[model samples]
Target chain A: MSSPDDKRRTIRDVAKAAGVSISTASNALNGIGRTNAETREKVKRVADELGFRPNALARGLLTKRSHAIGMLTNDTYGRLTLPMAAGVSEILVDHGVSLFLCATNNDPRLAKLHLDALLDRQVDGIIFTATRIDLEPPPELLKLGIPVIYAFAQGPADSVSFHPDDAQGARIAVQHLHTLGRSRILHITGEQNYLAARIRADAYRELAGPSGQVMFGEWSEEWGHSAIDTVYSQSGPKPDAIFCGSDEIARGVIDALRDRGVSIPDDVAVVGFDNWEVVSKQTRPPLTTIDMELKELGHRAGLAILGLSRREKLEPGIVRLPCSLVARGSA
Target chain B: MSSPDDKRRTIRDVAKAAGVSISTASNALNGIGRTNAETREKVKRVADELGFRPNALARGLLTKRSHAIGMLTNDTYGRLTLPMAAGVSEILVDHGVSLFLCATNNDPRLAKLHLDALLDRQVDGIIFTATRIDLEPPPELLKLGIPVIYAFAQGPADSVSFHPDDAQGARIAVQHLHTLGRSRILHITGEQNYLAARIRADAYRELAGPSGQVMFGEWSEEWGHSAIDTVYSQSGPKPDAIFCGSDEIARGVIDALRDRGVSIPDDVAVVGFDNWEVVSKQTRPPLTTIDMELKELGHRAGLAILGLSRREKLEPGIVRLPCSLVARGSA
Candidate 1:
């Protein structure tokens, strides 16, 4: 192994060794050039073998970018967004960008304070984990014209976002039961106004084929109980399967149903969304849910934001990542 | 409505209102014996009426503190710790302290860099969120000798920490089951070396009486299922109830049981821990688990670390907060 004690190699050394200009060597190393593939590969290999790691600051200076992605989150309670932020960070780290994370917890003046904290740090791009954009983003964020993407959910207004395919996710739930030859499916989901609920509701109607059983409320266990209770009210051939909008709702649906002497699968199979192990794996009946792949969302958001300026046109819009099923006993 | 044009009122304005020197007014506000209680109350009431809030920055300068706390999270991938950090932030926010937050993404090298960043910005105190103390804290962080409390689990060495009362938490589970007139309860848990698992095991052994079943393994749904299977293999009157180490394991156990068409509560009641809505509320049977209230842990850690110094010859070594049983249908 090359020792740190050995003559430390710089990008200049690599450029000299490869008989190329410093900028050309940097462009090759960073994959930002129109050089021939052979030349790029040869220079890269030599740079790696010589341990010629370019000075990030110098590269940033030349590129006129920080290569630092900002993650805006709630303060003090930054924990809720930490995992999601970590996912974004992991993706950016591999791309050689540092994560500039900021939180606004103490004061909920909405995004005003937190947004300021992030922008002041001059991050190249931003990823927000909140379900909605809470405050009117200072026009400065848009005027600065940085590439921003909302992960998990969309921010307010016309900000382009990357969201899980919710309707498709619900379709998978319906299909899983359909494949098992189960009809009479009941949909238990979060509040009506949420975009997730709207999309999933549309999917249930599409798959359940008219007379679809749709129940809506908050993403809480109590909502699950209440929704199930309402479903049980009309006792004419109750649903044989249930599609829960989230794992939380599914858990409540199962529990409330079980309490009513309804057996899961035998009487009604169940499926959930969001593969949070603490909820699904710990529940009495392991739920088959959709994996939103949050980490992947962060990774893509990082890459997308970092590469925002690559195309000099405003092509920002929704980038829907696919959702997949994680089958367990309940479904 | 209050005018947006109004400048935020401050202590100097309050002192001016009471026609007192800044020192005399500060003594009154802080009750440092330079002013009588009656004078203090009068001055406070006047300050309130004028909406004069203490200028925390200016005051912190006087106090040689920031009236702000820094949080350095060693790892963010572990979703369980998020609540702990959130709780701390929530509590600190209520107490009116700005929290400077950063995550290490579980990289010690990055953690050091963050420490340097926080130090460069001059944070008053730090709450290091971790399951263990950092073996090698940044040299400057150590040099700053600012108070730091390792919240969530025990510190790596003999540093201060705040964790849920796992021993008492386990006892609560056993006692809850016992109250249900079910004595044949099995204890399923995680790695014995983890501080929480060890304390929980001790509590189970001591408070569970002789017939209670006890077992340990990694905290996962797979382990929960295997543990239950092992207990049933013994055959002699299968356990009427099971106390799971975590919500994940409980979900697995319940899934396996449901797959076998076993009944819950009627045939076997199951209880789990960590009432994480992210996971627990989404499970089938909506697991009956312990609410560790991690948000409160973060809050306490914020205060403990900032209010009392680790190097100062004061304060407690460890603080074990209470955990509560969030009763749900699985049990």
Candidate 2:
């Protein structure tokens, strides 16, 4: 007599009926597994009677695929890695692959120590999100032979990756301003050595007609402030709109502009990259920036790794995902 | 003949020079550990000539401590956990402890699986970052009796904890608005079921003086937009300032206000929590916020757990950290 909604069954309800941990229930139902046959059968029997349809991951595991993804970021970039990893996790979770995440502190000494830990546990594939793609990955990391994809920053290795299409995102910004009848765009950026910054600066110039100016600096509010001061002192029709490389740089520009009583959008339209929510939310005018779909990158990485794990012909090389223009009041 | 800095010392560097991992070198350095004494002596002689300072972790493991902290995070709030765990790991690394970090999808079943994995490896202590506090931990888990520290959120079992002082943070927001000559202020929030939200809402009312207004609802941008709409329509005086419960709500309120041509600061000053860099950097006017200092929180939890492992009286109960204000253009 009860509605279907009233009879909804959970892993817990099934676990209690089968006398096991929720993990056991999960393992039994989705068995690329590490659980006993008896436990799996008992849990499966309960799940069947409850009219439960197991998640895709459980189903994938039975075929020896585990349908799971492994994610790794070193502890050094702790602040940025979590959200990036979270975005990756959500994408994989939706695609029915469980994500096994691990973090290390960028201690080169512990490189193999921590990564091998994830490999030993047998994640179908791996995603390495690095803060600084500063060095070549250890040769041993290559030994695992699982599909390992790098995100956010690319590494010195020949693994697959789906990075933020910084070049495309920058070109979009430059083109947006040109379409709006604005000229003399300025490029503000982080350190010159950064891989993404280099691509973005190149794009800004190629797209900013003939007279666009570019400034290079570190990723800091102070750098942004310094860039604004540099722009203010220049002797020319001040660049109509500043195409900031990162939101941090944009804030510096916006703050300096406000301090000098310069009206935003009206006086100097600003477009920033990296739709980083934490930094973006606090701005005076909600900023219009580029949305780098990191989760999608994670999904692509997961799929690539899964494909590689099956000894399938993995499409070799890079995957650069498209970045979206998020128009807010700033541009 | 070399200066002390250039001088070659011995102990483990020779082992490191042999191209094996540091832990392997560590095993070689301590003749009493698992390695063959010949390997240990060879490593020791190489270390002596190479003048390698034995890594504290390598040295420390010899005298009854693994110098490792095992962290388990519920996948539900992994966004928060990732940064917190990273913060803790960095702190532990600084203290010469390697972090054994694992993500448990907040399922008790998986938690037990990971817990057993960590325990068998004999981590010094554990730090748990979770969302919910009501679920009972496994009896075997409870019986393990390792020192556990809960961060950002609580657990049902008795343990040590450290969380931001949300009450004080809310009070600071209200007090800041009071000084800004704003009388009618509104509170936009997340669901009441969250302990953090409830504490913040209660704090808002207590701090907002008698003439202020409080609006409680879900913690989404949509809720902020709708709540602001409701306040603007039937409200007693329009809220002069909006004290959003989270960064997400603040972003929505700002968007809603701007679409209606309402200016920030000149209209409604805004404040948010979590100081997520994403929102702060992307928004036009950077959000003025209270930095939850997640990394610092992790540091404390790591230290607390380590202290507990030594059978030291880790004062059982919550440790509330002070939140610092990050001033930006929004307010």
Give all candidates' CA lDDT scores: 0.69, 0.69
Fraction of native Cα-Cα interface contacts (under 8 Å, chains A and B) also present in model 1: 0.17
User: What lDDT would candidate 2 get against the real structure?
Assistant: 0.69
Question: DockQ numbers for every candidate?
Answer: 0.12, 0.09
Off by over 4 Å in 2: A1-70, A75-79, A91-100, A119-125, A132-135, A138-147, B1-79, B87-149, B157-161, B165-293, B299-331
Fraction of true A-B contacts recovered by candidate 2: 0.07
Local lDDT at A142 for model 2: 60
Instruction: Report the poorest 10 consecutive residues by lDDT, candidate 2 chain A.
Output: A53-62
Q: What's candidate 2's i-RMS value? A: 13.4
Q: What is the TM-score of each candidate against the true structure?
A: 0.62, 0.59
RMSD of 2: 10.9
lDDT tens digits, residue span A83-168, model 2: 56555654554444555455666666556555554543345677777765444555555655466776765644456666777899
